[model samples]
Each structure stands twice: as C-alpha cells, then as structure tokens.
Target: MSKTILYARVSTADQTLDHQKAQAEASGFVIDEVVADHGVSGVSTTLRERLEGKRLYDKLRHGDTLVVRWVDRLGRNYQDVTDTIRHFMRQGVVIKTVVNGMTFDGATQDPMREAVRDALIAFMAATAQAQAEATKEAQRAGIKAAKHAGGKYRGKKPSFSRNTFQVVKEQLDIGQGASAIAKLTGISRQAVLRIRKDPSLADEALKRWGE
Candidate 1:
C-alpha cells in the first residue's frame, strides 16, 4: 500500500488552506501528511521550488499518491505545472486531484496514449503560464496608465491600518520575537525589526498602545 500526501498551497495570507484540505477530505482521501506553503507567490515559485513545496521532491516515494486541489495549485503557468507533474509521474508517483479525481500515472502501457497525455499536459501548462504572463502584462500596462493619470484607481490599497502597527509594538514588548510578532500581527518581520532598531520607532509603537 502506498502512502498518500496532501499538498495545499495558499499564495496569499488572505487565502485559507483549510478549505482545500476540507475538499480533499470530503472526497475520501485520508490525508496521511500535509505539506503547505504559505505566502508563496505561485507565479514565480513552482510546486517544487517552494519551502514546503520542495519537500515533496524528497518525501514522495515511488508508490506514494500526491494530491492537490487543482493543477494551478502546482504552478501559476503551464510549464511549471507540467514539468512538476511529469517529473513526479516519471518517478512512479500517481497524482490525484480533488477537483476531478484526475490521475496521472506512468503505469499506462500505450506509448501513443502516453504521448497524447504528455502533449495535453504541455498544452495545459503552457496555457497556465501564458495566463500568468498576460496578467502581469496587464498590471504593468495599468500601472503605466495610472502613472500618467495619477494612478489612484488601479487596484486594492494596502490595509496598513494604524491598529496593526500598534499590535506589532505591544507584541514586541511582550517578548515576542520579530517573526512571531509578524505572524501574529500580519505585518512583516522586517517591519518589526525596523521598529526595534530605532528608539524613535519604539516611541511610535508605544503611542499606538491606546489607539
């Protein structure tokens, strides 16, 4: 009996991994182990390159079953996703999807069928990559247009509320390290360190205690 591994990737802090896991469980997968990569941008980081994502390359054995919500969860573009899939498939790993019980395995006997499968994988991966590229290009164009037109209405604004900055400071005083403070407050560790670096910043953080 082969082991089953569940991989759930949430690119942004706003996205929840629970939902993906729930979907996999609801579909009858035991989920022996879970590998999650958080705050990792799917566009630049492929399924193999991520911090936890890289673990799959080493952990998955020949008969292990790898599960994901969708192909896009593997990569933002088609090539990244395809390469990741084909590499694992060649290693005798079977990839199972929660979205549609789709399975990709190297056990198929027909060469022509394999070729067709490979081609289809290529097409899908390419399409995913193209879509990511197009989205980036569109953002660039939008930014350029905004630069000429005062750029205010392009996308969502950063939610750097004053309250968040305050929580960051208090957490520091409570003996929370920079990483913990960032994780708890949803701010970056770099930002927390910056505050600790300057006494002036401490003063600012202290002020935030009441508000």
Candidate 2:
C-alpha cells in the first residue's frame, strides 16, 4: 500500500502542527503517519539535519506519498530543497504540498511534464531561499536600527527557564541545530537561533528580568 505521510514544521512554539495536519486532511490525504519538527527554524537547518526530518528518510518507502504544508517546510535553500525533492522523487516517492496543491511525481516518463515539474521545483526552492535571506536581512536591519537608537539589542525575552537557557547555550556550543534545541527545551526555534547568533543579547534579557 502506498502510505500518505505528513511532514510538518513550525519555527515558533506558539504555532501548532495540528493546523498543518488539518490542512493535509482537508486536501484529501489519508495520512498514515505524521512527522513534525515543531519550533524548528528552516532558515538554518536542512530537512535531513532536523530531528524529525531524519526520521522521514527512514520511514518513507517507495510508492509512498510525502505531504507538507509547503515547499519551505522541506528546506529554505534552493539547492537543499531541490536536491531533497529530487532525491525523494528518484526513490519513487510522490511529494505533495497542501498550500498550493503542488505535486511532484517522478513516475512520469513524459519529457515535457518532467521539465515542467523540475521547473516548478526550482522556482519554489529559489523563492524559499530568497524569502529566508530577506527575513534574515530584515532582522539584521532591525537590530542595527535599535543599536543606533541607543537601545541595547536585547532580543525578545524567552519564556523559558534559566536551565533551559543553559541547555540552549551548551547545545549551541556543541554545534547542535536550533531545531533540536527548541525541541528539547520546548522554546521557540527563533529563541534558540537568537541565542546562537548572540548569546550576550539573550543573557541581557535574562538579566533584565532577573532570571
């Protein structure tokens, strides 16, 4: 049987994976399994490197269908996203996205259809990469503006414990992915990335709150 599997991700703890699953179900996918990487940043982590993402590789079989909210959930870089999709296609797995109802099937031998499919994949991947870069640049600009205004760049105060902060720092020092840290601590992936990018800012926020 060709099983339908749902792979969902969110960058913030406040976001729920249930909505993604519901979207899939509404799209008529009879999902047999669901793999989620909640509070995981797609900008910094490749799909394969994510905790639940790795499990997808092991779980999906030939003839299976993989469903996602969008192509960005698969990856945020053009090369990474395209490569991942092609890899799955080559393995006889069909990829579907709930948002746009996009489908990528490698089973087709028609040259024209294959070209169109590849082109769509490239476009989506490029768009995802561009969006991620734009978002990062915007964040940098915001931080710079704040610093210029004589405001210390204390990022948002994370709603986690001091121990969670310690674990975040340790994970970052050891080169752990933000998604993994967020998963372990139940904090937003953005929070983990913020600490990874500048622990000092996060520390300042903690101090300000007397944590």
Question: lDDT per residue, candidate 2, 1-211, as tens digits?
Answer: 7799999877754545766788889888898998887656887888989999989888888999999989998879899899999999998999999988999979999999999999999999999999989988998998999899998776655677788899999988898998788789887776776678788877877887678
lDDT of each: 0.76, 0.85
Model 1, position 44, has a per-residue lDDT of: 79
Best by TM-score: 2
Which whole-number lDDT from 0 to 100 does residue 79 have in model 2? 90
TM-score (all chains, Cα) for each model: 0.72, 0.74
The per-prediction CA RMSD against the true structure, in angstroms, equals: 5.7, 6.1
Can you list the residue pairs that collide in candidate 1?
Answer: 77-128, 77-129, 78-125, 78-129
Question: Cα deviation in Å at residue 82, candidate 1?
Answer: 2.2
Q: Mark the regions of model 1 whose C-alpha exceeds 4 Å error after superposition.
A: 152-155, 159-161, 172-211
Query: What is the number of backbone collisions in each predicted candidate, taken in the order shown?
Result: 4, 0
